[model samples]
Target: MDATKMAAVGLSASYGRGPAITDINLEFGPNSATAIIGPSGCGKSTFIRCLNRMHETAPRATVTGKVFLDGEDIYEQDPTAVRRRIGMVFQRPNPFATMTIFDNVAAALRFNGRHSREETDKIVYESLQAAALWEEVKDHLFAGATSLSGGQQQRLCIARALAAQPEVLLMDEPCSALDPISTAKVEDLIFTLKRTYTVIIVTHNMQQAARVADRTAFFYLGKLIEVNDTKEIFERPKEKLTEGYVSGRFG
Candidate 1:
């Protein structure tokens, strides 16, 4: 599948009364990873949600400005198509409790409705392998998804997203609820996935951002404070605010 570059222009979002993020502009290249780093309620989550049209799904939420996927405006495209091309994983592992591990991955392919049973099986296997989960779950494909540990569940969710063959993947604090070992596994998976998929991850863990992201964007109350290469962002940030936040002086 072809990877997609994403850009936001004059972007802003609001929950009816006040804006969550305002006039933010950023560009992400294909097959790269960019981390969105900020404190709680800094609009990091809202901003990533807008990338794939998830923000507008919230009640009373509205977005202004444009998000472009490979130069085409996402807002002007069909919402279902936009979402299909961009897949999301939430903060918590959210496997369908009733579905088997294989079914969970197959469900995404089924929803797209173009693949035959043979093709679906192939995709599911490949996705699980891509997520580095195949070795652990291959023996229990038909078992309940919730039977896996928290980390395994998260990896299964990633495999499900991969099964869609999305051009872009959006992850919102995907490792926040996992143990240190689980978090490290996910981090390694992120590093590997960027070789083929453009990934945007919203995370509160600064070190995780440093470990996984090639580029880093720092957000503050409703605005983007700074963005730069990961090394520069951590070592020699141009903005004092960015320095303060990264240095643990203040958030």
Candidate 2:
């Protein structure tokens, strides 16, 4: 197995004193893919956000326990710096409608103090290519990002995340808004991406999780019920709850 890139030790989180998830422990390996799978409202998204310190963005949201990146406590460090190294992509394509595609991809690099225009341009193009969007949008770099299709917009958001060159990428249902074909494209991208960056995705689609993840974790009512290799989780789950959920008996 690859070295651990991220780990949660007894992680617990809540909204306004109401616990959303508790005692969650998991480790994500470098250059590997892990998927958090469960029904809606199972705290899967909350868990991923906690990994990158984004859980604090919500009013009244609080997190306890430890999140370690390369064995360093992330919460003890600067949240801004943690986010820069652990990028995220949301369920919808959140491109800035007012900005052009090029600007959208360049925003993070600029914010992080990449001042040279030549370097910014090079990073933007390279990141887009890494996200598999460059060939399609290369000629329209300055077009309004919103002018693209939903699939293209999602890919653009991915490119924007990649621009930061994060060591770990946390995605919350990244392909939820895309069509089947677009979802397939993103799935392929995720598979290929594990060769370069660790990926943890929260997905409700069982087939999607099975298709792209090396490991799958099942959460229920704020508790992780089981976690194991994808084949074991889907084909021969160890726990009754895991088997029921994966076999479509119940969510």
Candidate 3:
């Protein structure tokens, strides 16, 4: 599948008071993985939220500039549709407490008004396979989502996101809370995800960024400092601020 093209032009966002991101501009290509890295409160999460129009969901939040998906401004389109096409997986695994594993992935299908049992089953199975969870959960399709381990639950969330067939996946610290093994699994899944979906990840772990991202964008104080290939960003950053942060001089 050809990757979807997306860009944010002169984007700035505020929470009814101060700007969280300022005059930010960036472009993303299909089937590419870009990592947004910075310290806490540097707007890494906020920027990705704006990409899919989720930032506006906050109370009294305000946004300026345009986010384009396939050359059309997303802010001018239905927010729900924008989100479905650009799915987000959060830092924590937040599976539906009451739903079974199958139901969790199926929820997305149901929301889109797809009701055929045969098709739903097929989609659910395929999505689980895509998420790299089918082998682990195939026998327990009806198990409660909460019954899974932290890692399994996170993959389940990824499966849920995949069921919608999003062209882009915005993962905000998706593995921060998991153990090393689980984190590795999610990282591997990310590499596979970018083969067909555009991936934008916000992570404080620079090493993780290097492992998964094709290109890395560095942000500081709500502004983009430098962006380049992951190796260049770490070995030869052009901006002093980026150099300091990546070199462990300051975070």
Candidate 4:
């Protein structure tokens, strides 16, 4: 594989006693998008959350494995630093309610370090542009974040994450809450984003996975059943489990 931006080796995560995901070994290449697809409770979300140490935020959660970023063990680094390098977007839109659209993105830049107003402004604008929300809200940058529609709010959250200059973006069912039109917009943005960032998205929408991902991984009962080219996985899965899931015979 071309130099991977991130990899997980013998990774497992759990809440207290029972493991949610077990021994996941995967690699994500630079500048490509990978979709994790499985039925609900299949550990798709749990696996990605462990990627950036977000899994530890849960009560009594434990992780035992190695996650490497560019050949460096991320578990040995500061959790905050690891998260900054691997930003995430949740299933629902979660822009800060009190901050304006510009401020929401600016908050990420400010949190990373001190920047002059001009520098912050430039980054905020560019981030918004990257999320494809600039033209819609440029004139009202100071408007409250909650004022935007559901789709706009989700894109704003994406812009906020981008403002942090992350190398990888993890999206857990990012469009599950949006209408079809909004979902299409986010899909377009995903296409644009994979050109620069290594993107990993966990989605239950098989069609969405087929549309947006270069590769797709299927998980079943907390285990990764198969990982392969999107076309191959959908059309000709190597494993029987993968074939059954892709063919809608079982989840």
The C-alpha stretches of model 1 lying farther than 4 A from their native spots are 1-4
Residue 93, candidate 2: Cα error in Å is 0.7
Candidate 3: pairs in clash = none
> Any idea what lDDT model 3 has?
0.93
After TM-score superposition, the amount by which residue 200's alpha carbon in candidate 4 deviates from its true location, in angstroms, is 0.4
**Location of the lowest summed lDDT over 10 successive residues in candidate 2:** 109-118
In terms of lDDT, the poorest run of 10 residues in model 4 is: 242-251
- Can you tell me which runs of candidate 2 are displaced by over 4 Å? none
Tens digits of per-residue lDDT for model 1 on 98-141? Answer: 99999999987786778888999899999999999999998889
Clashing pairs in 1: none
Cα lDDT tens digits for candidate 3, 71-182: 9999999999898899899999999999999999999999787579999999899999999999999999999999999999999999999999899999999999999999
Candidate 4: clashing pairs of residues:
none
lDDT of each: 0.94, 0.93, 0.93, 0.94
